[model samples]
Structures are given as structure tokens and as C-alpha cells.
Target: MKISPSELISVLAQFNPWWRGGHIAGLPAWKRAAWHELNQWVTQPPVHRAVLLSGARQVGKTTLLLQCIEDLLQQGVPAANILYVTFDHPMLKLGGIDAVLAAWREREPRAEGIEYLFLDEAQFIRDWGTWVKHQIDFVKDRRIVFTGSATPLLEADQESGVGRWHAIRITTLSFYEYLHIKQLALPELPPLRSLRHLFDWTAPDFYRVTELAAPYTGHFHEYLVRGGFPQTAQIESVAQAQRLLREDIIDKVLKRDMTALFGVRRILDLEHTFLYLCMHDGGLLDMTDLCSNLQVKRPTAQHFIELLEATHLIYRLPPFGYGKDVLRARYKVYLADAAISSAVLLKGKNILDDPTALGVATETAVFRHLFARYYAQQVRFTYWRGKQEREVDVVAEVGGQIVPFEVKYRTQHTGVRELKGLMELCQQKNISRGYVVTKALDDFGLLAGTPEGINIMRLPAPLLCYWMGEAELHGVVE
Candidate 1:
């Protein structure tokens, strides 16, 4: 059902009320820190590229776009010159981005002024990459920002992007952001050199660090169940949060977004695969078992997994290998947020009391932190599995240096033997230090070996995740 031009004009008027000599709507005050970077790109002098903000569903990409527009309005960008359109609007499908903008221009023909155009849910537009690229080439003195759900648009834009598009990914809230949202007060954490080596308890100041971070034990527990999606973060009741998570996050992605975006026909198969994933959130992906469990063909199982990743509902981390086919190795799959797992599996009951779920959920929280923080960088996040089934949860490889992180969610002393995977990987890679994220213990010291060996650092997971969210790791990784 194509909409008439007058209908689009009416919708455009509603979207850009400021165009009619009225006040711009005030943006939400609870801004994500990612907005700071967007402001930098907007205010920078040589703003050539279209700023692209991409993230999973409900991670506040649309809110971030509105915040950016609000900032522009506050900075004296002419309201009439700015255009904000959500591509998913039914009327928007009648005419594409170019047509709507053309109609807006026809309504108010004013040249010699810079315009800021924001297109939300840009993936809905057909041939969006080419259209965006063309806009960059033809539109002069115009700053454009696009927010999308799918990631393939990234690859397409990269091919034609050249100096025309800069991408910034927005993930669910980090642990620190969660804290900020909850308004929790915390004691100062012991200073660290960089995020990569933040848990380096090999340092002599380990005792002081442990004492400082021990107070937030309960908060970390809540974080695992609540997770970091801004919408569900504030809901006090567990069941209520789970309901919203199912209806808002899971159902939307599985029912509407996947079908609309990827043309997924067997939604039941996709739902089954996702349920299996939720049950085994931070575990290895065994397609043989998954196929048998879901009663789907191998290709169907693989298709479901790929589609899940495309919609940003899950993450698939490959095993670490040197100069070999890493893709062929077994992969560890996890829900995009810890709360998703809790909502689907635990029904929003706090997992900290349950040892089994707590361990996996803790690792899920750690992965979310690293993912939200370092995904834009040139870091390869993989897991390490050695002989005798010794494994490290996360192995971050940057510039030929390997940092193995083991998640042992116990609040006691973990012996050297328990760190077999971390020790072996450090020895194999000739690295010095490794970390174990613990539930509460902050024990940090070295395990001396014949001649020399890697230092074993035990740090609190909550503090580490919080610090990671607060700082940038790109400079340290380089």
C-alpha cells in the first residue's frame, strides 16, 4: 500500500515539528556515553563521512540519533534545515529516503544552508548502501547520520564508503552504564594502566585493589539478572522485567525483525535454535547436538545461527588458532546480553544464588563488556581449549600478544592447577600475565615455575567489568 505524497508530507511535518518555527523536542536526559563520540563527529570541522550508528535491537540506536539531533538543535543548527525520518514508518515505504527529502525540499525551497539528515532503521530502505553513497556524493554541505539493525549494511557501505561513511557501533549498556542508570555509589577503584591489563594482580598493590572492590558484590549479582538493556534495567520486579524482555527484545527479534529483515521462513526452527542457545548461553556450539535437539537439518541449523548473529541477538566466538582455519574450529555461542539468558532460562530470578547459572552468566557479562568496549577495534576475541578439556573463557589477541581470561565465579582461592588453560596458553604464546575473573575474591599474585612462568591475577569480575565500561581500550590495544 503506497502512501500519497501528502501523507508523507504530513508525517514529515510530525517528525520535524521544528520546521514550522516551533521548538525542537527536548531529548532524553539519560544519555549513553556513546553520544559523546557522536557529538565529536558532528562538531568536527572536516565532517565528510556519513556517521553510521549500528547496534542490536533496543540498544538505544534510535535514542542516540534523537540525542544527536537534539544536540544539533541546541548548537544552533537551523531546525528547518534538519530532516529526521524513520525508514520503518509505513508511509516512508511509499517513497524512499531520496523522495521524501525531495518532497521536503519542494515544501521549503531554501538553498545555501547546511542540513542535518537522520535516517533511523536505515536497513529497511532498499539499496540503502548505494542510496547513502549517492547522497554523500550529490548532497553538498549536508551532514547525514544513519542508524540500522543489520550488519551486512556495514560491509556494503565499506565497499562504497571510502571517505564517505564512518561507523560507530552501539551495544547494550555496559556494567558501568548499568550502575550509572541505577544510581549506585561506589568506592574508588584502584587505578590501572590499561583495560587489557586491568586485572593484572601481579602488581604489588593487589590487596588494596581487592579491598576497594569488595563492596559491590550484591550489585554484580543484580547486573547478571537485569543485564544492560536500558529499558529493562530500571524495572524493579523480576517477572515484569522478564515479560518486557520476552515481548520487547526476544519476540520482536525472533518474530518481526528476523522475518522482515532476512526473510526467515521457518521461524519455529529459528525459535527452537534460539531457545537451545539460551539454555546453553556461554557454551560451545555443537551442531550435531543442536540438530538432533531441534530436529532441523544441518543447513537449517547453520542458517538459524547466522540469522541470529545478523540480528545481533547472539554472539559466536571462535576458538583461537595460529595460522590455521579458525572458522573450522568449534565456536562458543552466547546471548547478546546476560539478561536475555536470564529472561529466557531463569524467568528473571537472580542467578547469583545458583552456582551453575551464575558462572555462565558471569562470563556472559564479561563477554558483553569486552564486546561493547573493543568490538570496533582490531581485536580478535576467541576462546582457548587445550588437552584434557582445559579451557579459557576469553582469549583476546591484539598485535600478536595473547591475553587469556578465565572466568571462575567462585569466591575463594583458585590454585595454579585450576588455571591450567591460562598457564598453558601463556607458556605456549610466551606471554607473562593472565587473569581470572572471580565472584568476590581479588587475590593477585604470581605462580612461579621452573625458570619462569605467567603471573596469575585474581580480580573481582564486577569491578573489572565496571572499569572496562568506564574507559576506552583502543589506545591500549594498539
Candidate 2:
């Protein structure tokens, strides 16, 4: 039911606790990276575009927007000039984005300052992109920032927000960020140049690198199980975290987001496919096999997979190839969060205690960290599967430079022979260097091939994963 403007203002007052002459009580600390970006966008010279913030549900999109509001208030911006509206609120939903803005204008028609519009869960407003475009086109003084759950907004922004929005994706925390969030102490890390040299077999930094990362090895196992969701990472109990993940992340995405956005009928089939995909995390997926196993038609199976991917619940990694040919190759499916798989399949059990499970979870974790590395960048990351069932976990290509990486988490598989897939791909692509991510083997050396062949390098998994998120990816502080 539609509520009056007075009720709407009351709701706004509740969400913006700072408007009540005090700071927001119990506001969780915001991520440094997100805070920095918002600060840059706000304090800089006025730009003509709105900043589109997108991520999976419960990844702290709302919290980040609230923190931005707090930041603006602290920076001498009037509280009245900052408008924070949650589109998903039932009362707000009844009036839509335009009506909410109109109400705010009516409340203070003569307010004379540069206004900030923070629209949270903006996908709930129908045709939000068109409304935002209209606002920015006609009312150029206002700075508009909107957050989406990543299902509809991604598509909407592409259609209506072209060249008018700066998109920022707030993914789950990286292992480095996870450490600081959990208050865990890590030893001093080596320099970024030394870490990058680990990818070169001829470099002499392998021993020092292992020594630097030794203290954080055990925490990697925890990161894999806990995954990177902000709230789940904060929970101390594994079982409790898993339960919350299953309910807040998994079930909600499937039942609420998928249905509302995709008009999905027979949700059980879609859910079953998701569960199956989680069980086979990081494994090659054959559509024919999946269709038969799920007892659904090919079209239905394809639709379900597409919907899952669009909602950011899972990611499909295809084989490296050019253009349309890449679509023909079989792809591997990975849960967006490692904990989604661990929560469903292992029931919050510590993966470190189980060797086989640990290996699989490690591969999933590697894919996630790599995904975060290139999420907003122009790089394309894929998996390489060769004949004889050989495979590499991640193959990244940027500006025609192909870097193949293999994740071999088993203690026994850190030898040169285990990186056959990466080496073969590197040779075929004419790339000189490759990396092998291992459990603990930190030594790197040139693996001499037959006459007329090139040498490849192997690096430790812990160091590579940490470096990928920390320095190599440009998101972490060195």
C-alpha cells in the first residue's frame, strides 16, 4: 500500500540515523577499498555520471552506501542535501524512484546545496535506469549513486546508462582483507617485485617468499571454508556461518532474486541444478550430462544455468579460444563463493582436515580470487583443459599476453610433471612463463623441455593467491 510523504520521511529518518543528531549505531566498519572509491568520486570535481554499485546480495552494498552518507555528512555537506532512499522498502516501492525524489523536493524546496542521491537496491524501481538518466540529463547539479543486487541492474545499466555511469563491483573480501577484518596477525610480506618474480623460475626469491607466507598458510584453509561474504567471515562458528550462508546467500538468491527477476517456474529444477553444480565445483560441465542427470530438457537446463550465472551465484569458465569458437568448448562451473559449495556439500566441516576436499576447495578458492582480480578490469580469465583429462585452473590473457596457472593443492602433486596442462598450453600459445600453485612447495626452477622447447615456472599457491589479490590485482595495499 502507498504511504504518505510523512510516513516516507519517517522511514528515511530511521535509516539515516545521523539525521537524528547522532552517528549510526552498530554500523559495521566499511571496507577500505570501497570507502576510498566513494571518497574519490564525491570529493573530486563534479562529473556528469552517476556511480553504479553492484554485487551479490548481502555483500554490503547497502552498508557501503550508508557509509558514504556518513562520509558526506562529515565532509561539511548538509544532512538535508544527502538523500538516502532504499527502493526495496515497501512504502518506497509503492511510489517509485520519481515519486520518492518528488517527495524529497517538496519537503525542502528551497534547500540550496549540491545534492547527493543515494538509491539503494535500485533494481526494485521499474525502469530505474531511464529515471536516473532523465534526472542526470535535466538536473545536472545532483550527484546520483545507485546500488543494485547485480541481476537486473547489470542489464539495465548497459541499456540505459551507457557512458553515464561508473560501475563499481563490491565482491567478497580477499584473503588479505579477510585477515584484517578478522583481526588476524600476518607476518611481514615481501615486496611486490619479489612476489612477481615467483612466476619466473630463474628468480632467486622463492625461498624468501615461502618464509614470508608460512604463517598465513593455515588461514587460507579458513578462508576457503568461510568464503568471502562480509557477514559470514565475521561469524566465529563454522556451523553458524554455513547456516547463514545457506539461508542468506543461497536460498534467498534462488527463491527470491531468481524468481523475481527471471520469472522462473519449477524452481526445484533450477535449485537442483545449482546444488549439482556446487557438488561439482571446479569440474568441467557437459550440458548433455547435466541435462540427463537433472532429468530436464536441454533448453530448461541451459536457461537455469544462464539465470544462475546472471545472478552471480555461479561463474562459468570457458576454454581459451577466440570469439565464437570459445562458446563451443566445454566450460567449467564454479560457485561464486567457496563457502556455497562447502556449506552445501561439506556442511561447514573444516576442509583442511580432509585432503581430497581441501584440494577441491583450494581450486575453488583460487578461481574466486582470480575472478575478483579481473572483475572490473579488461582481462579475460579462463580454464585450460587438454587431452588426456589434463587441466589448468586459471589462464589469464591481457593485451595478448597469456599467463597459464595450474592449481595443484595436493602435497604430492607439486612436481613439474603435475603442471603438464599449463606447460602444454604455454608452449602452444608461444608464452614463455607459467605458474603452478601448490600446497606448500615454494621452490621454482626452469623445467627444461625436449630440444626446441621453452622453460616454465612453478610458484606456491599461497603466495600466488595472496599476490593476485594484494598487489598484482591493484586492489590491496602492499
Q: Once model 1 is optimally superposed onto the true structure by TM-score, how far is the C-alpha of residue 115 displaced, in angstroms?
A: 1.5
Q: What is the C-alpha lDDT profile of model 2 across 220-301, one tens digit per residue?
A: 7788888788898899998888888888888888998777777887889998999889878888888898998999999899
User: Could you give me the TM-score of model 2 versus the true structure?
Assistant: 0.92
Pairs clashing within candidate 1: none
Worst window of 10 by summed lDDT in candidate 2: 193-202
- Candidate 1 overall lDDT versus native: 0.78
Residue 269, candidate 1: Cα error in Å is 0.6
